[model samples]
Target: MYEPFFEMTNTPFRNDIDTDALYLSSDMSEVLSRLEYAAARQLFAVVTADVGCGKSTAIRRFTSKLSKENYEILYLSDSKLTPRWFYKGLLDQLGIESKFYRGDARRQLHQQLEIIHGIYKKHVVTIVDEAHLLAKETLEEIRFLLNTKMDSHQPMSLILVGQNELWDKLKLQHYAAIRQRIDLKCEIPQYDLSQTHEYIAAHLSYSGGAKEVFTDKAIDEIYRYSAGSARAINKLCTHALIYAAQRAKKLIDDHMIREVIAGELP
Candidate 1:
C-alpha cells in the first residue's frame, strides 16, 4: 500500500534472506571467517545461533562463495530425526538409489562416498541445517560417517547448522564425542546499534527508500524495539512504512514509530 506514495521501487523489508542486503556486522564477519577457515582446512564445523540470527543466510553466502570445482557439496535443509531417514535423504539428494533397506542405508552411503572420493579431486562436503532436531541415533550416525576414511583423506567435511539450543544439547556428556569432533564453533550474535542502522538502511536502499522515508529518530526507535535482530527490525520498519504511507505522511518520526509499536499503524 506504500510503494508509489513513498516513491519506492520495492518493499524494503521482506523477510527473505537477500544477500544483496546482507549487513556484515562484527559478529557476522567473525562467523564468516571461522567458517572459511574451517572449510579451507577441511575441518568439521558447527554453526549455532539463536533463531532469526541469520544462520541460514550466512551459510548460504558461504556455500555460494565456495569454489564449486574444489568442493562437491550435499546440502540437506529439511532434516529427519532418524539415522535411516537422514541417509535416505542424502542418497536422494545425490541421485543415488536407496534401494537397500533402512538397515543397509549406512553401508550404501559409505560405498557411495568411496566412489565420490575416488572420482572427485576436491573434498566432499555435507551440510545439515536444523541439525539440533536430529535424534541421538541420527547424530551418532553422523559422527560415525565423519569418522570414515578414504585413502588418507577424511571421509567428508561436515557442517552442522542449528539454533542456540544446539549448544545446550551438545553439552550432554553422551554427545561429547560429536562435540569434540567439531573443529570450529561459531555463533551469530544479534546486531548491535550501528549494525542495526546499517541493516535498515541497506534494506531501504534495496527498496529504493534512499530519500529518507524514515527519519533519524524513527530509525533509532526501530533499533530499540527490534533489539537488534534483523527479522524484528524488518517487521517493524515494513509496517512503519505502511503506516506512514496510509497517513499520507512523507517522513516517519518518533510518533509514527510509536504508532507502529502501539498496533495503531494501518
Candidate 2:
C-alpha cells in the first residue's frame, strides 16, 4: 500500500529480504568470523542472543557463504527434540532412514559422517537451533556424541544456537560437561542506538526511497520501544509505513511512531 507513496520499488522491513542486502553490524561480523572458524575446524560452538536479535540471520549468511563442494550443512530446530529423534533428525537430512533405537541410529550417523569426512573429503556442519529448550537427556547425548574415537575428535561440527537463556543454562554446574566442550562461544548483542539508526537506513535503502523517510526523533522513539531488536524494529516500521500511507504522510515522525506503538503494537 505504501510503495507508491514512498516511491519505493520494494517494500522495506520484509522478512524475506535477501541476505546479501541485509545489514551486517560490527558485532555480527565478529560472530560470523567465529562461526566460520568453528565450521572449518569441526568444533563445537555455542551462539546465544536475545529473542529476535538476528541469530537466524547470521546463521543464514554464514551457511550461504560456505562452499557446498567442501561443506555439508544440516539444520534442525525442534523444541521438543529427544536423543533418539536428534540422531534421527540429522540422519533424515542426509537421506538416511534412522534405526528405531537411539544407539543404532547414533552409530549409523557416525559411520556416514566418517565416510563423508575420510572419503569424500567434505565437512559436515550441524546446527541445532532453539537449543535452549532441549531436554537434559538430549543435552547429555550431545556431550557423548562428541566423545567418539576415545575422545579424540568430533566427526561433524556442532553448533548450538539459542536465546540468551541457553548460555545461562550452560553456566550451571549440571551442564558444565557439555559447556566445557564448546570450543567457541559467540553472542549476538542487540544493536545500540547508532546501529539501530543504520539498520533502519539500510533496510529503507532497499525501498529506493530517501533513507530520511524516518526522522531522527522517530528512530529515538523506535529505539526506546524496541530497544534495538531487529524484529521489533521491522514490525514497528512496517506498521508505521502502513499508518503513514493511510494518512498520506510520506515521512514518519516520532508522533507517528508513538501512535503506532500505542494503538497497533502490543
Candidate 3:
C-alpha cells in the first residue's frame, strides 16, 4: 500500500526479504565468520540470542554461503522434539528410514553420516533450532550422539540455535555435559542506538528511498520502542511507513512515530 507513496520498488522491512538484503553489521560479520569456522571443522556450536534479536537471520546468512556440493544441510525446529524423534528427523532428511528404537535409530544415523563423509566426501551440517525448548533428555541424547569413534571426532557440524535462555539452561550442572561438548558459542546482542539508526536507514535505502523520509527525532523514537532488536525495528518502521502513506505525509517525525506505535503496533 505504501510502495507508491514512499517511491519504493517494494516493501523492504519484511520477514521474507532476501538474505543479501540483511544488515552486515560488524558483530554479525564476526558471528558469521565464527560459524563458518565451526562448519569447516565439523564442530559443535551454539548460537543464542534474545527473542527477535536476529539469531535466525544470522543462521540464514551463514547457511546461504555454504556450497551445496561440499555440504549437506539438515535443519530441524521442533519444540517438542524427543531423543527418538530427533534421530528420526535427521534420518528422514537423509532419506533413510529410522529404526523404531532410539539406539537403533542412533546407530543408523551414525552409519549414514560416516558414509557421507568417508565415501560421498560431503560434510553434514545439522542445525537444531528452538533448542532451548527441547527436553533435557533430548539434549542429553545429543551429547551421546556426538560421542563417536572413541570420542575422537563428531560425524557432523552440529549447531544449536535458541534464545539466550538456552545458554542459561546450559550453564546449569544438569546440562554440564552438553555444555562441555560445545566447541564454539556465538551470542548475538541487540543493536545499540547507533546501529538502530543505521538499521532504519538501511531498510529505507533498500526500498529505494533516496532522501531521509524519517527525521532523526523519529528514529530516536523507534530506538526507544524497539530497543535495538532487528525484528522490532523492522516492524516499527514498516508500520510507520504505512501510517505515513495513509495520511499522505511526506516526512515522519517523532510525533508521527508515536501515533503509529500507539495505533498500529502491539
Off by over 4 Å in 3: none
- The local distance difference test score of each candidate is 0.80, 0.93, 0.91
lDDT of 1 by residue, 1-266 (tens): 88888787877777664665666787888888888777776778989987777888788778777888887788886656577778888898878878557658877887777777677766667888999888888888888777755424557778899998888899899999988887888888888878887887777777765567778888888888878877788788878877878888988997889888998433
- Measured by lDDT, the strongest candidate is 2
As for candidate 3, its clashing pairs are none
Candidate 2 regions exceeding 4 Å error are: none
Q: Candidate 3: minimum summed lDDT over ten consecutive residues — where? A: 202-211
Candidate 3, residue 164: the lDDT equals 95
Instruction: Kindly report which residue stretches of model 1 are placed more than 4 angstroms away from their true locations once superposed.
Output: 99-103, 150-152, 264-266
Q: Is candidate 1 or 2 superior in TM-score?
A: 2
> What would the per-residue lDDT of candidate 3 be over residues 181-230, giving only the tens digit for each residue?
99999989999989887877777778886458889999999999988899
Candidate 1, residue 140: Cα displacement in angstroms equals: 0.8
Better structure of 1 and 3 per lDDT: 3
Query: Model 2 — which ten-residue stretch has the worst lDDT?
Result: 10-19
- Provide TM-scores for the models: 0.90, 0.97, 0.98
